[model samples]
Target chain A: MMKRSAIAFSAITATMATAGVVQATTLEDVKAKGFVQCGVSQGLPGFSNFDDKGNWTGVDVDVCRAVAAAVFGDATKVKYTPLSAKERFTALQSGEIDVLSRNTTWTQTRDTALGLNFTGVNYYDGQGFMVRKDLGVKSALELSGAAVCTNTGTTTELNLADYFRANSMDYKVVAFEKADEVVAAYDAGRCDVYTTDQSGLYAQRIKLKEPDAHMVLPEVISKEPLGPVTRHGDDEWFDIVKWTLNCMLNSEEMGVTSANVGDMAGSDNPGIKRLLGSEGDAGKNLGLDPGWCEAIVTQVGNYGESFAANLGPETPLKIERGLNALWTQGGIQYAPPIR
Target chain B: MSTNHDISTAPAKPPIWNDPVYRGIFFQVLVLGAVVLFGLYIFNNTAENLERQGIASGFGFMNTTAGFGIITHLVEYTEESSYGRAFLVGLLNTLLVSAVGVVLATLIGLLVGIARLSKNLLVSGIATVYIEVIRNIPLLLQIFFWYFAVLRSVPAPKNSIALLDTFFLNNRGLYSPAPMPQPGFMWIVIALIVAIVGIIIMRNWAHKRQERTGQPFHTFYVSLAILIGLPALAAIITGLPLAWEYPVLKGFNFQGGLVMIPEFVALLLALSIYTGAFIAEIVRAGILSVSHGQTEAASALGLRNNITLRLVVLPQALRVIIPPLTSQYLNLVKNSSLAAAIAYPELVSIFAGTVLNQTGQAVEVILITMGVYLTISLTISLFMNWYNKKMALVER
Candidate 1:
């Protein structure tokens, strides 16, 4: 925890130091540097977290690993820069990080006004409210006059205001800059309700002293399509990140798993052949090796595999793939074909 | 002397670099040119970067809707308020916290400073411990201690700790009765103003009479009576035109009162306490700067200890204290920006953090935020300079 706060403070100073340094041709820069400096959240379980041994994991981390695999054919050829929400964009804009995959929402203002390009939604999420079950608040409509705790510099605070005001309910918002501080405040009963993205709510619920005492309400207030973000002007880097997600989604749609990717490489299906770069020059088009898809699958796995590995029902967070499942699997995760 | 006569011959005129007046002007111009170039370099880089990234560069975003709610705003604000209004609200909150912290910290610091000078061991020892402990720790950690560790430990609002039936304390905040002035409150206000004018005139007359007749009057007692007694009389004649809106536990938290959130409490406590330690040392140094001869001289004239310290020692010490004391005041105000860490809705946290994030106008938002702090520092320094002048020694 001490190391984490120290990193956060340093990240702030680092962002300030590198402010307004334009990083164009980021693809060339990464290729020359031999690694992608990926900006991730300080620590959000089921998204991006650093373990005791300082290894990064989760869906967001896998996005960076996949990009590294596509670029250098090695998943380990990547570095992590943990950023707070307030520092994330500045870090990205100032060239501190090649790509920001910190579970950030893809809103219109951020996409247009913030000089950011949201490649594609890696996780389709929404604003959610969690409350202690003993409060007898079964639904969000019953949460009038409740004090809500959320992190600053995010859309959660704004969404909470819109939701409560639309429902004609009075509420107080207690915002903290750090995610853990919000969790701590909510756990300590400093607020009556905790609101954020649904995935975040599930992840932070475990931090409470009595995790079983809380229940997430059924209402989702806002559309929070979270994805990897790159600077707006760098079309090549944007294509690299966008295709990385599409490749993962397409591979999953084609029934490719990390365990069977090697065997599927020899398959006779033209679509599979084209996707794995065994028969087509799709990887060449993106300035990558021919076997870029194979490298990503063999190293990181498909989108579903990454999700089940990090946030499935068997995992601690137990987040369901309500909207993140593949198109054929009765969910909204659709990807463009490799061809 | 005749042997070294050739060495005394007039030397050749030196180069411009060796001429002190020319060198000073040349170096000053060089420095000014370098500074201007450096500033323009950054400006060009920022403009290019912003243009390349498609970030709009201007103050136009200030008029956009903030779409956020503030916990405690001095003026009216809602989600509908523009970002400009939100900036003003944040500025007011920052000034409010810093001003209150300055007053509270000065009082505590003065008391602690004087106690450290006490002959009693326990009193001085406690003051010493406080100064050492508080001054040694980082202010951010102290703020975290008060916020996450102390204030967050308070009980929930349902079981709020009541204070005098008009105040409540809970994890949410401290609730105190908000005074509501009625129609007749105007007459009381007018009466208080009249009493102040009357007292000022009386003080001037008393000073002249004392100088003429050498007969001292009880000016302090008379001034106190006029200030308080006039207000009391007006209130009674107007049937007590002030009402207290006591906080009641209506729903989730206290209502109908002035609420000070835990964020405010923790920020105020941390800033004041941490700054207070530094101030205590300053006060101690200032007091010690006064020579003991002044105190002995006063005692020789048969003045009491308190009177001698106030009339003789403090006046001299003020000269030493005012300069460094100005710096501490400025430091406290700037350090109040750390209120951003705990989500205190101060200038930096709200305007710089939320507005910057929402608008994505880093350059504009940061420039304006910096200007606010600059303005605040200048205002404080100007006020302190005037006060220092008023307290300056007038040597004959």
Candidate 2:
């Protein structure tokens, strides 16, 4: 009797398993849901953070907006899910978010082992250290035997360990799971040095009680190519999200700002015309309307515009575009041609 | 009689559905089969989904190097250690905090519970207020208050508060002298063990002598003296085979010795005080469940107040206390997981939070963590049940 029941149970499960295999495409799922679910950081200023009025704005946030514009032609059709460092990849892999636009580094292990793919680098960053002025530590070499505070589950933690071990320095680590906790611990003098990406160091310095008291050290420990991530299987959705970032980068190279994109669409330059969707079939290749790039450029602006607005000199972070400028502008930021 | 026996024995069996014994067995078997099928379906579905997602599912990740640093570890762990060693480090840290928290909470709970029943109005009132306030507030908030508000307010390492030129207190940690054993320390250890064994034999003999002669012996005082004197004599004879290493200021912080990080102090304080409140209530209930007539009976037999309470009331009250006390202990162990929030590097913080994220083997890591907690809780339950059985009343 038990054997017969087991066979019947297996049959039922087989049917259920087959039924579960028929899943809708991510883009179609997003369209049906009427919004793109974007995973962002809990709060990292100039990357992805909320204002007092609850409006999200950042370079990373603009990536999500651009993707939403490319898909739905309305930048506001994106919902945000704030995730921590440890929870971000799981949130994307478990299908809880349509796209992960958080400031996540593109590492070999994460790109290959995990069921995720990095579309492109949005911001080129490197791990650095920040110390209080009173500590009088000018160079990274002077930071021997210092206690370092950093967020857990990030490349920064491993880099800090490697740097210290390579230099034969004795140091202690006080790793927290949240960025805010690491800041709090460092601010409370629990650690002598606060380490993260250089851009993050500048961003978090403003959150300190006395921002002027701390200074970033002159050390770039590791290459941190921060980018958006998507699940590995869906090629169509991945192409759309990937090209959305490319559209912004390409627009910047062609001097197509959001303010000038409307007028520039009628230009005689074939490159600008093709990029603005006035000449080529770029949007159709990604399964979108012809005016998809136009919507993205109009609503979320080009890459330079987003950078200058969120993380430029006028912002509290005052981060100079050292390694994040365009390739023609003496930095490594480059994108392929629209054609 | 034979005709009646035939009528009773040969009454027709009801239909199998109407028969209670057969029907019960059939339903049980049916439910058991359904449960087995449901479990199999879930297991198969999860495995299939994980495979489809391109995630490697297994315990192989435990062999990889966990290239992250933990803030605190009870075992010898470094970034070069395997993920399995990291798990052990996290487990040991969790056990260390939980064990210390249980012992401290019990001590505080017992004192407060007895104080609540004291004759002095001030004592009872204070105990009542402590229980009410602590039990009413949330434990996480209490942890935050201790970590951020109290411990972090201490002076930094540059201006550490030094005590007796040996210990120092700072926001980083409490640093003190660590004992280093010399070459002849083994002799001292042997002497201490021998003294303990001798004390146990002496205690048994004293108990028997008292039973026969109706006289009491001061076994506790003698055992305490021998425990201290034997070790001290051995140390003196061996030319004092111990040295103290004091923490001193190095570059940015103290360099060597023993340091208890503020995260641990805050977590231990929060866990002990919060769980202590519930234990106080349990202890109070256990004491109150004992009848007042038992105290009166002891006093009528010429026993003093303290002796009556200890010998008569407390012995009976403990039968009620041990069962509930076991639950409070289990709660303290579970509540130690909240240490993760304050960065204590316990099992959940370092293993589940950091290791799981680094490896991206969420299913395997979570299952292992859950298995660990289940094992710890079941062991506590088994030990407590055995203790409860021993304390149960004996009947003639």
Candidate 3:
């Protein structure tokens, strides 16, 4: 009887010990799972969306695939989970999705309170309104009691209320649960106006049946610095996600692209040598191979290539790099220099 | 002969494990022990995990200031209030939405359910189509279609179509006058409560009179008049002081009125319509479950169609309907969590997302949310169970 009780007690203790350890090397877990669970926005054009063949491609998807490439040596190792703004943070914290690259704003509350760590800003956006062109409303201030369709459960909704209130203009708000719904309602004439991050407005506008009928207003309301986020407990996983964005930014600054990364990796430039693993074991420090940065650039293209492919002027979304351009090019797309 | 006599007259206390009476007690104790130990293990692990991460495991986060901003709430709040206050606001909103949805769904569901059984083919067919379409589709999809596909299509404020002089319809949501409370409003409120109490007393008296003397009274209509008339009389006697803050057409939007955001509108409409479909089916099944012989007997005894339904069929049907209806109510309370999807500033968004991120207390934040839901579900269950026991058929 005593032996039986002892066995039961030991079993209970063992289970507790195993369960108490919250997070370990998330990289190992992702590798074992064979795919990185990537949280993405719902159908943000150029940021994340499914092609006709059901394959996801976008600026945001590249971030996920880049991380996957750095971890598992394969860029195709990603499982995309589409999330709205409200679902994005919980999904990250609850371990529903490994990394959230859904153009989520890094707010003070989110960074400090939500048990989440924003790795780095992937996109810098601002709250802006988009309206049908035939309305002849050139500026945000031109409209007084404008009925606007905005996303609910987001900072955008609050910002809209504040902007209209601060301006002392009376306006009505039509709030929707999803960005797609807001855009759809705007298209269907359910809402007189729609507001979101400027880039999102551009992407949504392109998806409209009457694309030319809408124009994005020039007034940028709130500062929205969007980035990838991870749960806070796992430092190793945090570093991996953080460095992936850094790699993209560093690669872009170093002029590395899918086409030219091979040549640069072999180049005699000290900066290139250090970054491409030609000089030292910087890759080992990150628990990756020396060619980790090289693989990311050659396989996924640098940040500039991704931006141009997804939302650049030549693309269907037709967004210009006014604020998104590289630091050297007068935009805010600058990163701390690679050591 | 001796061995046979010994077998027949042996002691009634069987072998140790073979005693069925002790066996039952042992099984119960074993089951109880397993459950207790399981719970203890989860508690221990959770405590250790919290300690390991240097995270404080408690409801202390509730007292901490919620610097996060919430978009739409039924109450006023600032960025510097305790998180507990925000949680209370969320709970109140959940109850508000659920209560409104339940009342609306019941009215519609009963009408549609009865109409489905109507003699008129056109009316029944319309009701049937509504049931088949709504019940077959998912609740979430219905919410999406309402918010995204249907409500989002409203025109801009400049193009807002006028609904009478006092209202306008645009994508922004229905706009109407904000109720302005006048002086002596408190007296009117008191009069309404007193009138409701009077109706309850009259209903009990009517029930007893009918039982004793087999006499009928128009209790419902009388109660309605008293409840409504008393309030109306008080408002008038107090100088009819309430005024309307009418919505005025402004340059780009409506001004000076209560605005219902489109998210709330869509969610309320979708939840009601979808849940109403199920409630209708339940009502239909319940009414059908009552034997047709009872209806035949009531009609054969010279009862009117409405009288037979109200007197005989409804009481039985309610017994069947009440249990399932209560479950649906609980489901609605839980499903309001979906409001987080559209940014409605409910518990999940504010407490789970904002609070969890701000504090880095994953287990605590999620557990609190889970606990809140569990409490809501369990409270509803307990109340409904008591009601069920009261209504359950008793064997003679």
lDDT of 2 by residue, A1-339 (tens): 999999999999999979878589998999999999999999999999998898999999999999999999999999999999999988998899999999999998898778888999999999999999998888999988898988878889899999998998988998887898889888988899999999999999989999999999999999999999998888889899889999999999999999988799789999998887879899788999889999998999999999999999989889888889999999999998999
Query: A1-339 in candidate 3: lDDT tens per residue?
Result: 999999999999999977766565678788778899999987888988888888898989999999988887789889999986656766776578999998888887677555578898888899999988988999999867676777755777667767876797655555556677667667777656788888888888877999888889989999999888887678888988888888888888988888988778778888888777888776787888888888888789889999999988889888888877889999988877556
- Complex DockQ per candidate: 0.53, 0.66, 0.29
Question: When only chain A is evaluated, what TM-score does every model earn?
Answer: 0.92, 0.94, 0.93
Give the winner by DockQ. 2
Which lDDT tens digits does candidate 3 get at residues B1-396?
A: 999999989888788799999999999999999999999989997676556433455777789876544545678776567778888777776777777888888888898988999999999999999999998998877777776754546766667777787788776567888999887789889998999899999999999999999999999899989989999999888987788899986665677778776667777888788888888888998899999999999989999999899888988888898899887878777777787665455677566655555565667778878998899888888988898788777779
Instruction: Give the range where candidate 2 chain A is weakest over 10 consecutive residues by summed lDDT.
Output: A16-25
Per-prediction interface RMSD in Å: 1.3, 1.2, 4.9
Superposed Cα deviation of residue A249, candidate 1 (Å): 0.9
TM-score: the better of candidates 2 and 3: 2
Better of 2 and 3 by DockQ: 2
**TM-score (all chains, Cα) for each model:** 0.93, 0.96, 0.82
Question: Model 1 Cα displacement at B165 (Å)?
Answer: 3.4
lDDT at residue B55 of model 1 (Cα atoms): 86
Best by TM-score: 2
The C-alpha stretches of model 1 lying farther than 4 A from their native spots are A1-24, B1-27
Please give the TM-score that candidate 2 achieves against the real structure: 0.96
